[model samples]
Target chain A: MGGSLNINHLLFLGHGALWTIGLSVIALVGGGLAGFLVALGRVSPSRTLRLLAATYVQLIQGTPLLVIMFLSFFGLAAIGFNISPLAAAGASMTIFVAAYLGEIWRGCIEAVPRPQWEAAEGLALSRSQRMVKVILPQAIRIATPPTVGFMVQIVKNTSLASVVGFVELTRSGQIINNSMFEPFLIYSIIAVVYFSLCYPLSRLSRRLERTALQKKPALA
Target chain B: MGLELDFSVVLDRWRSLLDGATLTLQLAFIAVVCGGIIGVFGAIGRRGGNPLVERLCGAYVEGIRNTPLLVQIFLVYFGLSSLGLKFSAFTVAAVALTINVGAYTTEIMRAGFDSIVKGQIEAAEGLGLSKAQIYWHVIIWPGIERVYPALTSQFVLLMLASSVTSQISAEELTAVANYIQSETYRSFETYIVVALIYVALSFVMRFGFWLLSLALFPRRRRLGTPL
Candidate 1:
């Protein structure tokens, strides 16, 4: 009840900041893989696969990530999965990120000109080959800006993991505040730390978007 | 351990869930309206001739956009009390959500404003329209219409994000689920039901926005296309 902010507190926060980065990496990689599949499913020729993917996106997009975290952490524990807070937070972030990234990538894939698809088909390429050889190379460029932008979302959303007791940046702030009894000062620091982590990515995403727009005329 | 899914226990607490859902909607409604207003002014300020106003607006947008809402909520929830200003959890939650969503709304609204071509403004001026008239008809209305879909999606996302307010104990639907699950010891069932309720709420919000768009943008309605 009578503690002041000190070096120890800053060190604790630095440690938590590292975990935040680690968890974000886990979510980005895992969610990127799952989201790629979801994107493919959305663009698939099979009607059933398209519907399945659409439903998944709808459900996850509709539900809040906080609820998903609670569901994975406590719901799974109740059903005997009994995973750690890190696992639960990681899985929830992956599921939530997948829905949004899948939608983003789907738009990217579809943004490839219709004529290009016809040309690939005219060249006697299979669907997979068309995707790999002709479509994806172009889609990747279009996907870069938004994907980077969504990374900012992923970084900020990791704060919600503290609810399940994951010792990330936010949780570390809470822990320190528990001792310091200084909410405003502590949370202000936490917000600054988060801003430092996110602002660069936001600038990068904007730069990428500008470059992408500038290149569009050349491509067309 | 064997898993036995039970819905009946959670269903018994439907009244609480309904009240929570109502509060959730109420919070979202207030934030959307207030945030929309802030967004309008913010967009104007950012694009205005005043450099100080533009820089302040820019900072506000960037600061809020780059930070997590949960921390912002905490800052608001405790920041007020520390200043010896007393407010309810609901008020704090609403204020925080409004502030958070306002930044996003500003960005979206600014994009809308930017999409207004210089030719349109020049044409309006050439037609002898007053500055106020030009700002209203040529600038604000069309700008909003251009960004209506993005604004709609942002409001829906704001609704989903209201769940984070439960951490400050605002007694929203998610908070209600936390309570019910603790009481019934049916965490899985309670969250599943709450999740479905949230999904329903999002659908309802989206539908409401669509209807509003129809009423607001008669041109869109007539042409059957979004501006």
Candidate 2:
């Protein structure tokens, strides 16, 4: 076993933390684009589109993310495609996040008061035009705080990517602990680093929620 | 070349998979019960306990919420062992899961508590209800009923999360899958079956919780509204 945790170990962990942040960003952006489509699909005019989207959400939401990751990793290999840990983790995260964000954004979209949609229709705006110009603008505002809060879940969940041998923060800590044999100390540092990364987002989410709550009163 | 898919090898290990699934449900059930208790009391502390207790509860919630369950699991696994305490992996997993979910449950319970109308509590007080009676009649039951949906979803998520405890070798479903996959060389099919099992488990739990809410709050059943 390595004698003790050193500056080098800390630096190694710092690198892993950066990767974790990178994975979170990739998951968010990729998931956001697909999730936006899923959200729109759920509320689309066509019943087929709505059923398809709803089925997709149900299937993903019903399964654990770890299984998704394993399926992506091994499933890809079984099909004869060489997959890197990054690609596997990123792809699975996109699928997982899309389902959840789709659900959340769909709620925000539906939360727009019925009167708003009726007013837009009353003005002779096409459905697409009405959505882009009116409904989405309002929905985006309502979706922000919860979206930010979900980011924390995204960050925490990315630790699972370590299971795919992705060498994120959690995996980095495991590597260090393997040699150091000081699981408590190494893992504690790992937890603290995660807390530092996530707690501010949590606080910001709560703050945004409070402001949103306050604004609702004045809006009413 | 055409790719072939097979499930026979994995299916042959059904007995072990069933055992693992049972352990997972048991672990989740224990954690939910213990965690639910912690959550109710912790919510109370945050809402009306002494300021010090309030701050500690707040910190506990924030600390656990911000970090990952994976890290929390590791900490619990290693932290306890460092103190020279020897316990089974199952015990450790359940304890860690309980502590982790308790914080989340506390937050949900707090929201439930907040949704209780002030006038209702006052009504309870004006009716000469004792403090404990006010807590039960005015605060706790109705609050939980309001947040029951949130609690159900969280508990389902908790069950899925228990798969992570397998990392510490807890002998849960994921761990069983890992072993079978390695042995059968059927990683993809193994995980697929396990995933289906999890989805099934979630559906079962959802239905169970619905039935539970029906039995727990008969007033809601009768009126179709919060009591």
Candidate 3:
């Protein structure tokens, strides 16, 4: 046991890493769709719709993701709905990611120059055409960097899913640490693995942010 | 889909939840202050031009930025104890949180510091002002003012993140809720109430930061926004 590191341990960690990526994808895609709606709602013509979306964003963004996981896990059960860990984690992540992403996209949408909106309206484009062809096309450029930046947050946050008994990377690391009694080695490796996954995205996001800043006027 | 919801069990433990939320806010408030000090120092160290200090600051910022808070908590709490260094869970939790937030605060402040116009600093220097005076008047205060919103948001995020301390059994909000749930066997009601409380705490934190900004930066409050 001392001489050779356990291949099985390595294998289990590898599997957990894959699930971490899987959970991230689920959160990202699901969150992106929900966020799109939230973003639209934030900019909706109706004041109630805008306020409803803003409240949703504020409530979700203020609370920690871990609490959301708990509510989704146990709250669903208490109301007598049978739920799985996957559904709980996935649902919680969707809501959690949507809040932040929606805000991010909202900023992007609003950042589209006022004149451009006027020009689109002047051109007699339909509302949908104004959004898709004129507005969203421009907002996507402003949104790319922060959107990618939040992805790193999403990946890091998925670690919290472990507490609800979803055995992702951190949970698997805890399991291994429990047996091997190697807190330093196990957590160090876990941190390194996380670093490896997140560092590139961090660098890329910063680069995007810098380039975006150079091109766009600062928005308060 | 077909069950009764009862708040009585959790409501009986209202005092416990209140204290927990109080502890959570206190932790966040203390960490923001302490971490701001560290962040300012780290920013200076990175820009200080001393090779070793710069490298050390860079590594510290990157290291903390890259790892998950849960692992950082473990290394500080369990790993250190394994290596014969001993401390209470609360101390370890605070230390870990401070270190984590300090790095983020460092990066945010660095951006603010970098954006200060060269002309302003040169003007301070041309007035026979000492470097320390120049930094205090021109750099630190204004930097904090410019990045006030970003810093407040990060601190709020830190407040939310204090939940991770439950992993170390630090008796913070999430930990208190955990204990209440175990005692009351009202897991759903407990978490729902706690979630709402966290939402309330964040709103309060935002209001507090806004008030503090007014007191700290009268120029900003009077003048149009700086950033």
Candidate of highest TM-score: 1
Cα lDDT tens digits, model 3, A188-216, are 88889988988898899989989988887
Per-residue CA lDDT of model 1 for B5-57, tens digit only, reads 99999999999999999999999999999999999999999998899999999
DockQ scores of all models, one per candidate:
0.92, 0.77, 0.69
After TM-score superposition, what is the CA distance of residue A2 in candidate 3 from its true location, in Å?
Answer: 9.1
RMSD of each: 1.0, 1.5, 2.1
Worst 10 residues of 2 chain B by lDDT: B218-227
Query: Which scores better on lDDT, 1 or 2?
Result: 1
Structure candidate 1, residue pairs in collision: none
Task: Give the TM-score ranking, best first.
Answer: 1, 2, 3
Prediction-by-prediction clash tally:
0, 0, 0
lDDT, candidate 3, B50-101, per-residue tens:
9999899998998888778988888888777988988888888889999999
| Deviation (Å) of A7 in candidate 1 | 0.6
Residue B146 CA displacement from its true place in model 1, Å: 0.8
Candidate 2 has an lDDT of 0.93
Judged by DockQ, which candidate is best? Answer: 1
Between candidates 1 and 2, the one scoring higher on TM-score is 1
Per-residue lDDT tens digits for candidate 2, residues B1-227, read 67777999989999999999999999999999999999999999999859999999999999999999999999998889999998999999999999999999999999999999999999888999999998888899989998999999999999999999999999999999988988987888899999999999999999999999889999888988743
